[model samples]
Structure formats: structure tokens, C-alpha cells
Target: MSANPLLAADCQDGCFFVDGRFVPADTTRDVTEPATGQRLGRCAIAGAEAMRSAIAGASAAQAAWAATPPRERAAVLLRAAQALQSHFDEGALAIARETGGIVPKGQHEMREAVVICQIAAGLPLQAQGQVLPSTPGRLSLATRVPHGVVGVISPFNFPLILGIRAVAPALALGNAVVLKPDPRTPVSGGTIMAEAFARAGLPAGLLQVLPGDAEAGEALVTDPRVPMIAFTGSPAVGRRIGELAGRHLKKVSLELGGANNLVVLDDADPDAAASAIAFGAWFHQGQICMASNRVLVHEAIAGAIRERLVGKATHLPVGDGASGQVALGPMIDARQLQRFDQIVKDTVEQGARLEAGGTHEGLCYKPTVLSGVKPGMRAFDEEPFGPLVNLVTFRSDEEAVTLANQSQGGLAAAVIGRDVARALAIGRRLNAGMVHINDQTVNDECTNPFGGPGLGGNGSAVGGPADIDEYTRWQWVTVKDAPPAFPF
Candidate 1:
């Protein structure tokens, strides 16, 4: 366990930042540590007035930020990355306690967050435009411009990293951002991020952190001044945000929930495949949107893969998040624990065999595996969003692909095989936006586009240089040798 207190003792009376200054809200919400169910700190829950102030502040700061050279804006992001690295120890411990991620995983995520900021900072140089062909003596150039004010709603699973992934690029692209962190694990992650930005010399109101529940989120997303929304969360909430953005004709980028699939071909090494799948299914207690919840194996290798996976699943240590030795940690809250229980019970009733796990104590649920899961089973169709893996067997590669594609979600998929050609071919047929061959789907790099297709996304891609492009708009400037013949 950490020698530091579960909650930041100084955080109880602290307020969020609006315009680079700490400001209190009309009300505050208590943030609880997931592991011990202890009240950690109080976060000011921004009311409508506070939300309006934040949006106004962002709108006011955007023009200047946009006018600032992209490289200069990117420099702030790089500095922020450096600041994050300098303070990683405290940040990692806070994230682990607040989000219930194991110490090692938390440290890794914090480091990745710093890397994301660095990559986002480099986006200015990466933002490229096209020189279109035009008539003689006419100079035509197209360049990307900022969207002004952006609102980002982040999830709890990766409180710091994913949030920074969106915020850094958005801010680096010259747009001011209003961040609504998940209420469950708010304090340390957002606080650390805000401090880093402040240290990087970000202008007042260029970045703001608002902590609250769904009401606060709705206030931020539905506000007309907030012209852009980048969200990462459940499908149900994604759809709701979509409807609101549609009504207002606002730009929105959504990375919603997923029921990712892992296909193990008969030709693959069973041990290697099982180990990879187990990690993908249980990492962060399978709370990740990219986690592989369905393992579809060729019938010929189903038995071998299942046995190996069962052994791996059973061996994972489940305990305190501060324990670096523990590979698994508790769910984010008791409500999630209950929901997971319901899904497991529903799947078992639908004829799926429980291979291992399914025991729950408070917010903790054991890493679970289920075999014989069919399309009709709840576990097969819905995203369990827990450390529960549904095993399905198929006779051929085509059938495995079909099974993987059966879900409404098309976030990500994985195929394990020795033959690169076979794996690539199978990966192509899968509906997910990203696929991995002979590796797990969790190996995401800052340079790779990480959004999904179908219900998993609203056709917007995050990460890579392309992401910086997404945060900005293009403007075509055409200069004629002589002003257009007439002022048509």
C-alpha cells in the first residue's frame, strides 16, 4: 500500500480552474477511492453558471491561441509533457488509488500520458496541407484552422492518459478546451494535468477542468458556445451526445464502448495465444473499451486455448490497487460490480459455461472466463465491461471473422497466427477499425489511429498526426494575379 494518504489531504477544500485560477463551485462532490470505498477528496461540481463561465473563458482565449503559431502552441504541450514526467510519481500513486488500477499499470499509464503529450505537441509540424493546381498567376493554398472552443468528456478507465490524449492535440492545434473528467476518479488525475498545463505557461482559460456527474456533462455538451465535443465512454451516452450535437449542428468525435474479439487460429501457438488473450481480457480488470471480451477460436484449437486461458485467468492476483505485484484490481465502483454480476448470471443462464471466476466482494470481481458462449448469449452480444471473457468456437477462419463481426461494436479485433499472410487476410475481413496479428490489441502507439468503426465511433479517428488535423479545419486561400475580374 502507498505510504501517502488515499486522498490528497489538501484537496478537500480545493476548487477547479476556470481561467488559470482556482475557483470554487456552488457545490462539491466527494470522490471515493475504489479499492477501500473510502472518501478521498471533494471536487467542485460545476454548476450551470460555472459551465457558462468556463465556456466563455474558452471562447475568449481561443482567438489568441489560434493566432499563436502552431509551433508555439505545440511547445506548450511539450513543456506540459516534461512537467508530467517530473511529477509522475505522485500522479501515478493518485491514479492508482483513485481509479483502482494496479501500481505498475498506473505507472505505465502515467508514462504513456506524458508520451501522448509529447506526440500531441509535435502535431504542429505534422499538420500538412495540399497545394492544389490552379490557373496561371493564381496562388492557391489550403491550411488547417482551429475550431475555437472544444469540450472533452473522458472516461474513468484511463482517467489521465486518454483525457490528455484528446486535450493535448486539441490545445496543440490552437483550440481552447473545457474538460469534464469522469466523476468517479476525478481529483489526482485532472489536478495533476491542470498543474502541468499551468507550469507549461498555458494562457489563462486555454485549458479548464470541470469535475461532476452526467448533469455537468450534459451542461457542457449541450452548450451552444462549446462548438466541438470529443467523448470517450459508453455507447448509450455516445448516442445521447450525438443527438445533442446533431440538434445544434456541432462537430463531435466519439470513441464509444466495444465488445472486442480475439480470434485464435488453429495454426497459432496455443500457449502464446492464451497468454496474450488473458492479458487483453483482464488488464485494468477488463474495464478498458479496447479490452478483448470475446475469444473466438477455431474449433480444432478451442480445447487447448480454453485450458490455457483458464489457467492464466485463475492465476491473476486480485487485491489492493497499490500492490505492484497484483496484476488485477477492483472495478471502479460497487455499481459496476453489480452490473458485472448481472451480466455473468445472465450469460450462465443462457447456456454458457463458467470456466473460472464470477465471485464478487464489494467493488472487486474475480477475472472471469465463460465457454460455449453463443451469439444469443448476453455475454456474446453486449460489452460486459469487466474482466469477463466469453469463449466461442468456430470451424473456419471465415466463420471466426463472421463471429467477431457479429457484434454491433466494431472497435478492435485480434488474430493470432504464425502465418503472417493468413493473419493479415483474416484481419482484413474483421469489421473493427484496428486489428493485430499474433499480438494483443492493447499495444497502441501514439502514432496509430485508435478509433473504431460502426457503433464504436462516429467516423472520427484519434491519435496519429491525423488527429491534430481532426481538431482543426481547413481554409483555402486563393490569390489572383489581378483581383477577380469583377467583384462577383
Candidate 2:
């Protein structure tokens, strides 16, 4: 109700961008400032009718937009990128206020979103079909076709990047999108996106932003017009979407839960390892799916690594992201705070040592580091999705690799050692889809493929050229110019 320190955009009307205009739904939902539990504003909550309209709009626009050539489609995305760049400060502030994410990280996510747009713009250069040798007088071609209307269900954490990451590529591949951003961060995650695309002269009804909760997501998933779904959220919800998509026989792409780790060998620089791992674990309050929640440090340098990590954690200024003094901000909401509390408590009760932190002041959680953690413990096995890391020691390189791969997680894994060759070798033994040699685990870029096997994702990487594969389906065609001579 009061003026927010980080407030940027005013959403007094509770409007959603649908059919090329800002329209209000009959019902509205409150968007809260997570750091203080303050009601920032009311946002439109879409009902079944609104969702059906959005789906129809996307379906109606798909054929024309698909026929509009990749160069023009890419031009629209490039224009959107520029427009979004001009609104960087406002959009970043919106993200900070909604998710308690630091403004700097918000800035990074927006800029990354811009880069993804630029990358998707280049998709036009990538030829989509291949001519295959066929029987006499018969010509065959295999082509990648757009999946028609794409349903994007994005998450609250890193909303801007996650939502736009899929949307840009889907649009580039000539498919219209229906985006449902988490209700908590609708403005940053969804609203600004529509503004940019509209400014870019994209066709009306090509992009729709509906901000709501589970009901809206269900509507999007069940809509038969949407032939594909791209989702970034919890594994539980992702599995449900997978099931629903399966029944409909629709394509699905998911960036789901992760149980990642950073392995530090005795030969590595302790300071470097500590710094990288701490940043990986605490940046964005460890809400990242790729956060290095499990730390496998050699027992020889365990004490030194522990001290450095602890020192770094305790010194970080924790407060509101808008304050500009805070290194890390608060959890998303009270439920997240409770989740971390129970995880830390259960971890400590199960024999892991709480080396530092494990305290909270209201919404702000102090960065936490746990030492002496072992297998079969929640902290070591599960993804806490909070500002915490469970530290465990290993004796040999063989054991370290074994422990890192034991989680059955396939998203990301890192090996930190001075010997580049050795780390590379050890990294090869890890089972994650993305491996970092002498670096942190929480690494991703628009130029790289980011997805995994097992529970991490649906094996469909969302960046680089992989986006083309995820957003399209293959079709084979055969044409005969004349009658073929049959070999009898």
C-alpha cells in the first residue's frame, strides 16, 4: 500500500496482456513483496474463459506468424530485446521487490534474457530440413516443423530468464506462446515480456501473458490447441505436467529439480574452491536448481575450505535486495523459510555439523554451511533450495567421484583441482549433463546446452541449438517426380 523502495512499475488495474491489449480479468490476486510480506499490488488471475481466449489467440496467430519467415520473426525478438533493455532498471526493480532477489542478479537475468533473444534471432540462419537420398524417381525430405502453440509455465525464481528463455526460442522457431508466470512475480516474469513484444511489432495474439496459479497452469496444460509445453519449476509439478502432456500426447520440455555438488580435491587451491562453492551455494539464496548443495572436499583441506566458506558466509550482508548493501536477500516466502528451517534442523539432528549460520532474522536467512555430512541424510541427498550447503569429506579421488555421482542427479557437477587434466578426467566420471572443470556448479549460458538426464530435466536442453530440437517436431515427406523403375 505504501511506496516501495524498489517499486518500479505500477499495476493498479490488475491487467493481463491478451489478444494484443492489456485486459482485466474478472478476478484478481494479490502479489506480495516476499521480503516484508507487504501487498505490492493486485494482479489479474485468469479463469477458464480467459485462458481459452489466450489459447485461441495463440492458435489463430500461429499460421500467419509461422509463414512470416525466420528473419522477420527474429527481427521481432531483436526489437523486443532492445525494448526490454531500455526498461532494464524498472524490470530489475520489479524482480527484486517480488522475489527478494538482489537487484544485481535481477539485472543479470534481464541481460541474459536479452542475449537469449539475440541468440534466438540467429535461428533463421540455421536451415531446418535435410534432403535424404531416396529410391529411384522418388525424392525424400526430413524437416523440422513448429509445434504450433507452445505453453510456457515458468517459475518464481529467476522468472525473467526462465520464462523468456523458452519464449524467445519458441517464437524464433515460429511458434506462438502462451506464458503463465508464477503469480508471485507476474510483472517481472510475464507482464514486461508482453510490453516488449508488442513494442517490437509482433503480430497481435502472438504472445499472451496470463499471471495466475495452479488453476491457470492446468488450463494451459489441458488445452489441446497447445501442442507443446515448456516448464521450469518443482519436480512434483513437473511430473504432473508430464503426466497430463502424456495423456494428450503433446511434447514437453522441463527444467526440473537438481541435487548438484562441487568436488574439491586436496591438490586444488583452497581459497579458490571456497570462493567458487560459496558463490554457487549462496548466490540468489541457493534457490537455483544448479546450486552446489553438496560439497565433497578432500579431508586434508577440509578445515581450510570450511574456514574460508564460513568466513565468506558470515560476512555477507543479508537484508532487502533493494537496500543495495545486502549480498543475499530473503527467501521467497514464509513457506520457504520453514522449508529451510526444517532441513537445517533435520540435517543437524542427523549428525551433520552446523559449521556456521543456520539462523534467520524474519525473512532473511543467514548463509549456512554444514560440515561432517554423509550419505542418507536429507541435506546431502535432497535439494533444500535455500541458502545452505552440506559439506562432506572424502579421502581418495575415486571416492570423491563416486560420492559426486551417487546422487543420480544429471543437471550439473563440478571438479575443483589444480591439475586441469586430473579434474577433467574426474569430471568425465561424473554423471551430470553439464560438467565444469575447475569451476563452480551453478554455471549456464545462452551459448551452451543446459538440461540433464534423470530428474533434472526431460532430456530436452533449452539453450543454443538444442532449443530448436525442443521446440519442433520432425516430419518426413516423399515426392515422386516420375515413375520409379522397380528392380525385380
Candidate 3:
């Protein structure tokens, strides 16, 4: 058994936390540490009936939870934030062990998770609406009220923050949440939140943790009791959820895949551009949605940037994350690594030159770089969620923006240039949801709007103010001192 307190406390049962207690699942699946292929422990899988019960329980509990005083609700979230802070080391370890991220990456997620909780704590009491001037002797106002039950489906990558970003705000805004975490990182993604909230004395049935596969996610999406669905994953899956939620007449928020681009202007420093590109594409093995999948460089400096990128890629450390020294760890599973390798191989075969680091020992695929990658190549067109950098050169700023906008996803984009005004102008022309000047694309803050348009998201955002809009609906109320004269 692992000595990590969080892992040891709940992995043995691998059970769902329903009504604030452990409920054994019908099936148990072994959880593996991707870095070493060691069995961490087993976890319960939520079956159809389990999902049904969880949803029904959430539906039943919503009214009272919503009726709870907003200050009290905010206090609970504040306590949960403290609980997460108190369990920082164990939480970071759990994230690294389950998601195959380096120790620092796990630490980043923990920090963001704490910020998410803290920001959400204040959301309950935020000014959610406005009072309107009305006709004489009448009181009129519009206020935000919680959606009865929210169903959250979070991805395996960056599991802790992604899941909690939704769960905390939804519960704080007086809504019950039925969260379905991806099975791969169940401990970090699901039970960790349960333990934190339970420690905070959240009322029973306010939050249900159901870790399961696609079927369980579908159950959560389709259940009539769940009025709103917040999902983060692949575009294909998000599209399906959109359709299903539409048919069910449910509100859905989708944060999907991205083919993010980091543009390097001719005037940008080659060293600075190269460092940002390497970090953007290789951090966490390029598993995040905002990772730079395409690097567009001005042709005047493309060769210099390419050379520096190759040098950096060949030297990055790749190994197990538990050591806390590796730059890149294993992919989450063999299947993911295989998919990554195949994409790189196909991109090479399609005539892009493979410049450096394409081989793998076990699950750690080395950071791979390719030059002369164009729009038609799979590496340029698809979201390569791996440690592969595809480089495309453009002769002019117009061409760079054009090439970047050709992508179907508009999740995130960045431009690097010494001329801040020029870079900002280029950013303004780019058709992406989030843009950064003189930086890489992999940037997010808990209080800022995160998500983009097009295939990347459904025009929905997650963060401080966005959470309020996402978890609640507007209701207009009007009152009079006495009954009005009836025209009828």
C-alpha cells in the first residue's frame, strides 16, 4: 500500500462517496501509476444503478442546499479551501502518481486547485444581479439563482483543478453537483474532492463523486435530474455531449480540444522564442488542451529558432515523476503513447523533417520536433496532445495569423515579438478565445475567462465571474405594495 495518506485512505475501497459515506461499487478496477506501471490500488467503478442513485440523491438534496444561507455556503467553501491547503503534499503526490505529471506539474495543479476553491468561496455572496427602476410604487429586481443539479465531467489531464473549478463554484452557488471524474485519475480527480469537502462539513448529498468510464458519464449527461452539464475533454466527446444535452433540453458547457499556436515574429529574440516554445509544447508531456501544438515562426528567423528548439528538445530529462527531477514523465497509458507516436510518424512520413528526439523507452516518448510542418499535415491540423513540436514558417505577419486561424479550434494562441504594439495588433486579428503577447499559449488563471470559441468550446467559460454565469440562472422578480388593478 502506498504511504500517501490520500491514496491509502480511499483507494482500497475504490468506492463512491454517496451521501457523505463510502458506498461499495459493483465493480473494482486496479489503478496504476503511469510512470512506473506500479499498481497504486483499486477503485470502485460506478455502474448504471449507482449513477441513477447519485443523481436522484442530488436532485432530492438541491432545494435545501440552495435554501441554505449564502454566507454559510461561502463558509463551507472557505473551510474546504483550508482543508485542501492542509493536505497540500498528499494532494500533489496523488496528482503526480495518477496523471503521470512531473512533481512540479502536480504542485502547479494543487496551487490552482487552492485558488479555485478560494475564489469560489467568495462567489456565493458576490453581487449576482441588479435592481431595476420600475413604475411608481413597484419594486423590481433581477437576481441569479442556482440551477438545481449540475453534472460535471472532468478529464484525466489536470484532474484536480479542472474538476474542482466546477464542483466548488456549483456547490457554493447553492447547487448540488453530480461529478463524474475520468476513471484514469479517479483518486486525484474524484475522491480527493470528496475528502476535502467532507472535512469542511458540507451537507450530505450536496456533492456526489462518481468515478467511471464513458457509460457513467453518459448516464450523468442523460439523467433528467441533472439540469446543467459542464464537461472538459476531447472535441469528439464534447460534440456528442452537446447533441445529447440538446435532445434532453439541458444546458451544457463544453471545454474541448485545441490545436493551439505560438507565433514567433521576426523581431523576437531567438533564445526567448525557443525557450517558450519548448516549455509550451513539452510541459506535462504536452497533455493539456492549451499546450502549443503548432509553432509558427517568421521565415527570416525560422532556422535560428528551429536550431535552438532542437537543442532544447534533445536535452530535456525524461523519467519517472516521483523522483521530482524529470522534465517529462510517461504518458498516462500505453494507448496514449502509441497514439502520440503514430501522429509523429505520420507527420514525418508526410514529408516534414524530424529534427530531434522521436524515440521512446517504455512509456516516456522523448520530445520530438519537426520543421517544415504545413497546414495539410496531420501534425499541423490535429491537436497533438503529446510531447511533439510541429514547426511551420510564415514569411509575413498576415501569413502567420492566416495559418494560425486556419485551425478549427480557437482555444488559445500567443505571439512573441519585441514590438509589443505589433504583437498585440497581431493578437487582435487572431480568431482565438484567449491570446497572449510575448508569451506561450499554456496560460490560465482561476479568475480570468478560460476557454475559446469554435471547436474548442461552446462559448462557455470557467473562472470567477464565468462560474457565476455558468452555475446560476437569472430570475426577474417584481412586487407591489398592494394588488394592482386588473385590466380583465
Identify the leading candidate in terms of lDDT.
3
lDDT tens per residue, model 1, 1-488: 33543334564344777899667667887888888878877778877677878889899999998889878888899998888777777778888998999987778877998899988887777735778899889988897878889999988898887788889989988899999888776665477778789889999999989887777788888898888899998998999999989899888999986668888888999989988888898899999888888889888998998898788777888888886768888899878888888999999999999999989777778889999999988888888889987889999888887788887766888889889899899998887878888887676887888888867788678898568667988889888767656666
lDDT of model 3, residue 283: 91
TM-score of each: 0.95, 0.95, 0.98
Tell me, by TM-score, which candidate is best.
3
**Off by more than 4 A, model 3:** 1-4, 10-12
lDDT of 2 by residue, 1-488 (tens): 22332223454248888888888678888888877778988788987778888999999999999899778988998998987787777778778888899999888888898899899888865989899998777789999889999999999899989999999999988899999988878887888788888888989898999987788888999999999999999888989999999999989998887678789989989988999999989999999988888889999999999999889987999999876889999999888889888999998999989988999998899999999899888888788999997898999989998888777575888999988998899888887889999899889888898988777878778899688888988999999877668999
lDDT by residue (1-488, candidate 3, tens digit) is: 22435444554367898988778787989889998999987778987789999999888888998999889999999888887887788888888989999888888888888888888889878897889999999989999999999999999999998899999999999999998988888888888899889889999998999888878888998999899999999999999999999999999989997678899999999999999999999999999899998999999999999899889888888999868888899889999889889889998999999999889999998999999899788898888899988999999889988998997766889999999999999999887789999999999988898889887899889886688889999999999989989999
In model 1, the worst 10-residue window by lDDT is 1-10
Over the full model, what C-alpha lDDT does candidate 3 score relative to the true structure? 0.89
Query: Which 10 consecutive positions of candidate 2 have the poorest summed lDDT?
Result: 1-10
Give every collision pair in model 2. Answer: none
